[model samples]
Target: MDLVFVFPVNLQKTKVLLSELSFFVNDEPAVIGLSENSDKLVWTGRLSPQKVLIFKIEYKGRGLDQFVYHLDPSLPVKNLRFISNIRGGSNYDYAPGVIPATAIEPHDQNNVSLTWDYKSLEAGVPVGLILPSEKSFSMLIATMTGRGWACYILFFISIVILTIHGGKKLKFYENYLISACFGFFFILLAYLAAFMNFYLAYGLSLLAVSALLYFYIRHLLASATAGYVVLILIVLFLTIPTLAVILQGYTGLIYTLEILVLLGMLLKLSTQRFFQNVMEELFGIL
Candidate 1:
């Protein structure tokens, strides 16, 4: 990349000192030189008050993610312009605080040209570009794990409350242990995602946790029917909600509808006195 700084001549100043003129690229020293009449010069001669001063810097590096240009506030610049021409296959976007480009054009094969211009510009915030890359895995995992934890907590609490209301008594310790196991499922998934593909790790983790819960519910209720009911609850409250989260932008709508549908089903079941009769018969309270 090449940067050119054009400073207009100050009539009152007799000489422009080259000692104070310097620039760094990527925190490393850059080659700075003077150019006059479109030709490179080994040394700057006496100050020409009527002529413009141009300083050119040349830099070479790999994986250049960002480039920042800061204007010195003390210097009087009549016009400031930046022209960027990057090779193909690399897409770049202007960072915040950067002045908008005035013109964008296609340069030579696989090259894009970008130009930024400002009249009577002053220094403030630095301007730069942001390079492009693939979607971040850490971000995806954070989204999934956050949603997963919420689903697990809701499902665990609902199941425990339903079991108690059905006249099947469970010790407080048992409830705590079951909930702990359910919460651990997401922790396991978070670690597994580091070593394997996220989707594959999530599926395997869900299968293992679901199977554990199925047998645990069967033992607690002493009925195969109760075990199947718990499995259905897992699918409706946990599995389906998790699928919704994976859908990204649509997750909010899907999760809201799922909660409403689940609530309606519970209300309908309660109005039928289904749970009340089952509790009465199971506990011999009737």
Candidate 2:
């Protein structure tokens, strides 16, 4: 056995092995030692190497933004396993001086589990998790603003490509309308999300904007290329960037990979007659 201390930190209720103020040893009930420190509950006992010991603690508390576990820096850690179950959110981070979890498992919808298993860990490492909190709409909008420049660039490039592929240059007013339709997608999503599920909002926005672009392009170009332009715009300007925004941590890498893939596709298309003609015309102007 080992000495255990539970410090009172705004905890409303605490339990050991599902019993209030109860302790157990080797499947038998045990008494807890009284602590002189009024702020903490302390217990100590001896253990047999042959017997299995299990300690389970349940805490009902609030007011703490993050939970942390401290390990003795001077002692070597062996055969240590830590598991945490979180509900309602998956966006989390590691606290300073804490090692990342070895594995993350999805427990259920809106639940996640993090595990850290170490066979022979050196001294001085601690374990902690910075729990995710609910984000306000303003905060989410700010985050989108910070990471959305690439999406705008990609949207503009798609429009330019669509213009070239149509073999008809877009008038200034037509270009403005394209830009307005693209911007309206985000505006519609933001408003729709306030009263409905996010996925539903996103889907509605995508469909609405896609239909608008299709009809507008079809009216202007009057070609089968309208469908291709809408498809490309949806994938490059909306879907991929939306994924990158949702993943958050992998934003830069996602954007870089997306840009490379788009460039490769453009290079491949450049060998085609229509694309070659467009490129020659574009370069001939210079």
Candidate 3:
């Protein structure tokens, strides 16, 4: 194989998977190519953005082995060890705009359509693993600022609510608060780990935070039930996917509104039971 591309990225930051792998062999590529199944990944914008990494392997195999990983920024060195592996297949689905029924109407549609459908919610990152062979690789690296003020702000609000809500169950909510904060620290972890990506770190944090919320809520409520499971699932469903998108670099209040809308829906639906019991459990309304 003359040209080969190996992908070692955190699946959570999946949107940029192809961009990353493509960069491995292609140092500076003129055109950005995406998987036909792009509608299935976490890609944020158009295939080719202006700022992309470009790399080209020398015809000589001198740099092929070195291409196993990126080394231009620094020399390889032994470290205080921390590495992560990405798991989970592409779970791309209808854009939130699609009706739930119509969205779920089809199956076996994981691959990106060769024909572009801009109206669809397929505006996501494209990832592809290229093999080393006689072919040349044009890698493009995208430098997107994955910053979302709404995520950050809701995070702040979540913290306040947890702190206030943790009356007698301070420990429980404190841990939940920790999970919320853990999401923030994940960014730093992404910055540190080479194979790790921001999406991976952020997505994993949801599971961590979810586990914490489950146990903490159980602790706060002193038991578990159908209701508690729903709460846990609610957090899991909302947080992980939301985290994935937010990590993509949309820093607008719309995200906050999205969260608010979800929370409102949750409140509208779950509040009757939540308020009836929450005040009693947290503030001892009884």
What TM-score does each of the candidates earn? 0.49, 0.51, 0.32
lDDT (10s digit) by residue, model 1, range 1-286: 2234343322222321222334444444555454564223233233445654443443332234555565666676667666665554346677777665788777654567777766775554444565444345557666666776677777865675567655576688878867776776677777886666678987987888788888988888887877788888788766777677677788889888888988897788767676756545546732
Cα-based lDDT for every prediction? 0.64, 0.71, 0.38
Better of 1 and 2 by lDDT: 2
Off by over 4 Å in 3: 1-193, 225-260, 263-286
The C-alpha stretches of model 2 lying farther than 4 A from their native spots are 1-132, 135-138, 284-286
RMSD to true structure for each model, in Å: 14.1, 13.0, 19.5
What is the model-wide C-alpha lDDT for candidate 2?
0.71
Worst 10 residues of 3 by lDDT: 135-144
Q: How well does model 1 score by local distance difference test?
A: 0.64
| Shift in Å, residue 256, candidate 3 | 7.2
User: What is residue 156's positional error in candidate 3, in angstroms?
Assistant: 7.8
